[model samples]
Target: MASSTVNRWLRPEVYPLFAAVGVAVGICGFQLVRNICTNPEVRVTKENRAAGVLDNFDEGEKYSQHFVRRFVRNKSPEIMPSINSFFSDPKL
Candidate 1:
């Protein structure tokens, strides 16, 4: 009589626990996929390849220096104020 009562109390509860865990796992998987699909910056549509352009070139340092010199702008010379515009100058 006691064995029958024990089985009856535990049998239905185990199925509900399994169902709850399954639902939790499904929800987590759905959220993970949704986040990955929403982000756009990391997409790679280009046919990217290893930079195999320099296999023939040995003087890479000269090319690098030339590119840097072209990219950088030189600072302008400081302006001096005339006698009339002396009040406009910050140095005054």
Candidate 2:
């Protein structure tokens, strides 16, 4: 009975569902870890827990310097330039 169930789950039609679930789980896990490691509100040490308002501000400033934020901040607001250009062309 267990073997039949496993075979059913292993079918090719189920592969895309598995891949989508795996990718969603992986992204959620990565973001959770990144927030735990980088977010200023997640203080782990006693010293960090005792940090003052000024220290919180400094930590927030440092947090804003995370590479992903910098890269996104510099990017153009348009997300799909090619599709936009194709649609926007007057000759179309």
Best prediction by TM-score: 2
* Model 2 lowest lDDT segment of ten: 48-57
TM-score (C-alpha) between model 2 and the true structure: 0.74
- Candidate 2 stretches with Cα past 4 Å from truth are 50-54
What TM-scores do the predictions have? 0.31, 0.74
Query: Per-residue lDDT of 1-92 in model 1, one digit per residue for the tens?
Result: 99998787668768898788889999999767744553232233343234333343444444444544765546333354365367765783
Model 1 score (lDDT): 0.57
Alpha-carbon error at 27 in model 1, in Å?
A: 0.9
Q: Best candidate per lDDT, number?
A: 2
RMSD of 2: 2.6
Q: Which lDDT tens digits does candidate 2 get at residues 8-58?
A: 899999999999999999999998997888887886688977885445687
